[model samples]
Target: MLQVKHLLADKGNRIYSVAPDEPVLAAIRTMADHTIGALLVMRGEELVGIVSERDYARKVILKGRSSSDTPVQDIMTSPVISVNPADTVDTCMRLCTDSRVRHLPVVENGKVVGVVSIGDLVKAVISEQGAEIEHLQRYIAG
Candidate 1:
């Protein structure tokens, strides 16, 4: 069973975050610039919320709210569901599915470490499958 730590070891567990007071537009711009879907919202060093593309589309665009005027705290998902380095990829998959969320921030000792998305877990699963297939093929060739 592959652990989240294995993934973080390769990715170096860096989480991009923004202040909760930042404008919603700032979050949107950050996502666009990073080519990512979400941003972890923080107040100083404390994790406060999470902003995603869905939040902007549903809360700001649909409601006709001005992103430049509204704060991310008004839109971000609070009390983010997080994971630990020791958590298994299967656990992360289940959490994302059950929560209906694509991103899960990893934390240790009350500090944000990294963020994992559904794509990350899927990629890991594919890599594991490929390795297993290669092993089986090698056995058959032998």
Candidate 2:
């Protein structure tokens, strides 16, 4: 079984984050600039929550909260569910589907190591399948 560690090994380790007191608009701008859907909300060096586009649409826009005035802590999802590098692709898929979240922070030893998206899991699975297909073809040719 392919584990998240394998995928992270290829993707590299970078935990993109924003401070909890930061304005929601700032998070939005970061997301836009980085082309990411979510930002991990941090309290200093520690993770506090997660903020996503959904939070902006539902909490800020729908609720009439000003993105420029509202802090990320006001709109973030707290106690965010995270994954570990040891988690398999199947586990990550289940977490994503069950939690209804696209992005997951990879934590190990109480420190954030990387982040994974549903797209990343899908890509890893596809690569695994391709390798298996190549192996089967080679066996047939032999």
lDDT of 2 by residue, 58-115 (tens): 9999998899999999999999999999999999999999999999998898888889
Segments in model 2 whose C-alpha atoms lie over 4 Å from true places: none
* Pairs with steric clashes in candidate 1: none
Query: lDDT for each of the candidates?
Result: 0.92, 0.92
lDDT for each residue of candidate 1 in 73-97, tens digit (9 for 90 to 100): 9999998999999999999999999
Instruction: Report how far residue 118 has shifted in candidate 1, in Å.
Output: 0.9
Candidate 1 off by > 4 Å: none
RMSD list, candidates in order: 0.9, 1.2
- Per-candidate TM equals 0.96, 0.94
| Model 1 weakest 10-residue run by lDDT | 9-18
Residue 33 error, candidate 1, Å: 1.1
| Residue-pair clashes per candidate | 0, 0
Residue 40 in candidate 1 has what lDDT? 96
